[model samples]
Target: MKVWILIFVCMFSMPLLVAVLHFRMRKGQTLKIRQDYVKNARYFGRSFSALVEKALPEMKNGMIMLSRQEKVLETDGKQEFVQPEIEDLIIARNTIFCPQQEDLHFQKEIYSEKDALFVKENIRLRAVYSKKRLLFGNKIRLLRWADAEHAVAVYDECDLGERVSSGEQLVIGFENVFHSLYAPVIRLGQRPEEPDRFMEERDPRIFRMPVMNSYEYNRHYIDDDMVTEGGTVPYTIISRGDIKVIEDIILQGDIHSDGAVRIMENASVLGNIFAENDILLEKNATVLGNIFTQGNIIFEEGASAGQPDKIISVVARGTITFYGGNNIYGYVVSEGGGKILKSDREISGEYCFPGEPVHEEKITFRDLSEYENVDFQGFRGDIYVKEAIIPEGASVIPKSQFFECRSLEKVYLPESVSVIEDYAFADCHVLKVWESIEKLSLKSVGISAFENCYALEFVSLPDSLTVIGGAAFAECVSVNKLIFSDTSLLKKIGDHAFRGCRNLKEVYLPDSVEYVGVSAFRDCSSLEQISVSEKIKNQPGIAELEKNCPNARIRFREVNSVEKE
Candidate 1:
């Protein structure tokens, strides 16, 4: 029993001895760690102090001083300058630290890597890194600042040639070798310019405006015709009634008439002319700007519009006719028809005469099976057939050939067809199905070829197609899917090509497609998936499509790889 009691006492004392030894070792480790931390902190403080001392001299010298005179000393000459902290420099430059009253017409100009102009009331100027031109409209002060060795200069002024009538002060600032300085001030007032004789001498019957002036008049007739010789009109002239310019007239501003406008021989107009009724330009007439009319427009012999390189459009709701020796440098658009009578006339721009669509009750194509080839160059008959078949070996479909066939439900395209021109099947609201004759040899589908076909649900593009022109399938709201042929050679899809296709759910764009124009697939609200190559997916055209259909899932694949949906 004594041996057992000794053993118990030893066991309890052993635990107490072990606890004292553990506490002593832990205290020694804590003391060493504290000493190491203190040594490292002292070294870091010395290194940071050395860095601040090295940067302080540069910071002090970089401070910009705005002075009234051009020559200024860097230091105060007698005493040594004390360098301010980086935070102090930033606060001094920031408007928040030194608030100033807002200047009403403050204009600021700063020279960036690119030339940039800014106009603001109270703002800090930042350095520019690229070369670009920027214009701002307001009055502001220009601020130039320097940091380290980099220097920036800013100047504020109105655009040099801008006409300002109000008395405004212009301030110019720049950075010199030693200091930032402002140049001598210049105050400008509105100049007194004389009005044109025609504008000064107003007539009740004729609308007359000088350059930089505008006027309106009632029904006017220029019987003398020579009254507009050497006349200058910088602003618009509007008339409520018919206008007749007899002969040898010259005017600068645009002319708008509610009734018919007639310009006699040797008349020249520098600006656009519009008429609610017909417009007639007689022999030797020259127009520099566009001509638009609701009624017919006629250009007689020796008439010219626009320069050779510039485009001046001529548009008319009715027919447009051009006589001999006419040189038109712009486009001509007519809703009804267009006729060019003279061979000597030169038209540099396109002439579009989308002839009236056939509006007849019914159309039949019973003889289509017998014909090996069909040509519809100027056919004006209705194409609203209940059923139509283009037999094999049929070659071409001319522009506007089958436009506005509202009742057409089915169409069969022949394998041998090579060309389908613009607006071939436009406005075919009921056309729901298309059957091709085995293989298609078609090369091009022109602008607005199948636009507004509301009943079309799906389309399988042919392999031989190379071009799809602008707005080819626009407003095809019911088209749910578009399948590209495995061997498609398509290269271009023009602007607004698939716009307003609300029900389009899936589309497969082949790697052969190189260009997808602006606004393509815009407003495709029901689009769920699109498959495209990586190169095509990153293009701006795809970005535009994504913007319009935010819910569409885009699957990008490498060229010649299996497509993912």
Candidate 2:
């Protein structure tokens, strides 16, 4: 009975010892698993493993492998496997897949220095997908030869396996040791939009500057816009359109254009010109011809044109401005003043002449001065001022003949004046125009009479005016704000009449204007608002005006109530 009791005690103690041993074994296994997961998570966070994994499919002839312990890659087969000699790693990242032969794709590590490889010229290159194809030793830079050195790569010549169809398996090795495989290429049916892989695309960096030289043509002239890309020519005549002297465009004869004319450094035009656009002469530019543009004119310092006795006539639609150092030996007519530098020189129908001993008309200034006095009496025809000289007691009496005073500015019309003729004061920069003219005596202002005056900003129109011709104030750039009280006289506004008045901010039109010309305010960028009469609603010109100035505010109201009438 005592022997039986002892055996029972041994059996019970044996289970207790076994239980302790099993518990220790489970704890060791759990620690090992936890350590492995932690190590992998740290590596992934440190190296941006997820981003590399996404970019790995772009690599070609290369593979990245991730094992339980570390990460490795297999590059092109051949040579001493020099890991540091690799190039165009980004190209490999954009071309080849990390795993080409296995179902489980390896998590890619693009930042890994050892994950990229490139085979140079005169070396054996074993393709990733081919066993039968072997490239002979030839001097060629793999992947590095692509146009974009940073990201894109293209192999000059490469061969793959025959069985590598749309979907196929490719073997991958770690450090030249074969380990796994994956499928990468996907063959497809005929594609029409794909670019031919053989043809090279254009790179913007390869463009070279154009070389230009002057060429002479006696009777022949180049009418179209000529663009040069760095070549040399001799004495050429450019006419009609925009002429750009990028390089030295030397002309033995005149260079004329109906459009804009631009001259850069070391350029010289020895002839006269008639331009419709602005003329821009850059540094060291020289023009031997008279420049006439229906637009603005600008010249940089060190630019010279014409002479005092043989001066060039400058006609502009807006202002004719020049740098302080530029020598302009010609007559400049702006709606503003002369010697205008650093300031805006507006072009009015005004001209400048030297003082004469005796005046041709009844009004004369005994002593010639920049500002003189004028006398208007006993003159049957319209009185005229030869120069910019203003005479004392100058008046525009009834039945007077005044056609074109090219250099007239700030002339006060007498209260007795009536019926001003057409084209009278056509381009005057009369700053205080019509200051003395009475409402009843003033009847008409000729067509195109006050077109391009840079300084004639305000005008007090007479209520008695009955007839205003076309193009009354076509291209007045400096006339920022205008309020017309007389609406019964304005009938028509001429075509393209106000094309380039970039500074005209506001204009008030009355119902008395029955017709509006085409492109009247075509390029008036500063014209913020225009109020038209209610009578012009649903009209073609009004519709065109709205379309052209979509940014400007338009208002349509009864003619009588437009301006507190």
Candidate 3:
């Protein structure tokens, strides 16, 4: 019994003694750690204060200025500027600081080598790519260089999940909420995958409201202004600020919009657009200017001013069709099929004119083969001849022949022919008349008599001509020189008839007439000089004479009679 009592007492006392010693040792370590921490904190504060002074000068203006000394002390040994930190922040040009810490707000901040805040943050980064502006929002903790998959997420900061895989696409912001940052897009490339589905998935609030940038957005805009994968589009999303674009834009340069692009009455776009699909412009939604497309073009019924002389060319794969009334000025060509349905209107040909009489002759296949020519013995009626002759006759006379002959080369007018009808000899090619009609009492020449004659170079009209037709000598590409002894008929030049006559170098028209056709002397590329009578100076066509013919020099000669000079 005495031995058992002794053993128990020893065990109990041993336990108490061990507990007291352990408590004392723990207290000593805690006190030592506290003292050391206090001592280091003072040193850190002093070093940071000195370094803050060193970095102040390099900070850019307008950025929120921080208390440099205080911020440095809080960072403790991590303050890189004063050389007190264990790790140093590397600041590079055109780079942003993406802090990994959760407590930090800005993932990317402008990197400045001299700013104390950047120095304390231990920012380590490199320049990825830069442009005019950059924006960010949401709880995006891990910031890395943008890849094809992460592009949309980086821009919108919304969870795209599997919908946005890669390639190019237009991303709509969340509800009336958009990423707060605005950047200019220079170049964009997009490969469409289910274009309609993507647009349909866009949030309505984002589509309805005006957008802008936020502080949570990158405070600093991009430098250098480059666009690697986005473009400036004619988007109808609501936004308050001016939408500025720096690059030549393309939605592929082609976009497929799911809904209507409605621009409010006050909104405007100062750029051009091209669409891959049909464009639906709702009523009251005004497009200020031109819109182009790669596919079919459709306009909803309403008063809409598209573009002035803007629909220069419209190409269709199947059939290009217009629904409502459209005013088209330029030439319209259809490769597949061109079908025109004219509404209530009368279309008639010009039948009555005071010129050559080519249509009145009783031309028979037998007459064309017999004389190698038909003699118009001054019969005052219009006549048409193709690859035939006008023989000199006392009773019967052939009038103006081959007025609008699309294909007929040579014509032989008889010497007895006195009154040549209007445009009788117009548009004739390879016409070689061997001076058969001598001293003929020719009175009038038709409009566009030799228009577009690529082969005829020189020909002589009768000296007794009084009325010269409008556009009589237009587009005679091969005819280079012409002479007229009658100075009085100079002012009666035809309209645009001489246009594109690349070989026509000299022309002489008399001053007897007063009215000239518009575009008469246009595009005479080879024309060296023109002699115009002073009497026709104030004529209507003369005002625009020099504007059209740049190669020709006009000689306002004092004229009673003149030849090609």
> Which candidate leads the pack in TM-score?
1
How does residue 105 of candidate 3 score in lDDT? 28
Candidate scoring better on lDDT of 1 and 2: 1
Q: After superposition, how far is residue 478 of candidate 3 from its true place, in Å?
A: 2.1
Q: What would the per-residue lDDT of candidate 1 be over residues 304-345, giving only the tens digit for each residue?
A: 565322334777898766564454543455776554442422
Among the numbered candidates, top lDDT falls to 1
Tell me the tens digit of each residue's lDDT in model 2 across 163-203: 11111111111111111111121101101122222102211
Off by over 4 Å in 1: 1-384, 561-565
Worst ten-residue run, lDDT, model 2?
A: 173-182
Of 1 and 3, which scores higher on lDDT? 1
Candidate 1 residue-wise lDDT at 28: 26
Ranked candidates, highest lDDT first: 1, 2, 3
Better of 2 and 3 by lDDT: 2
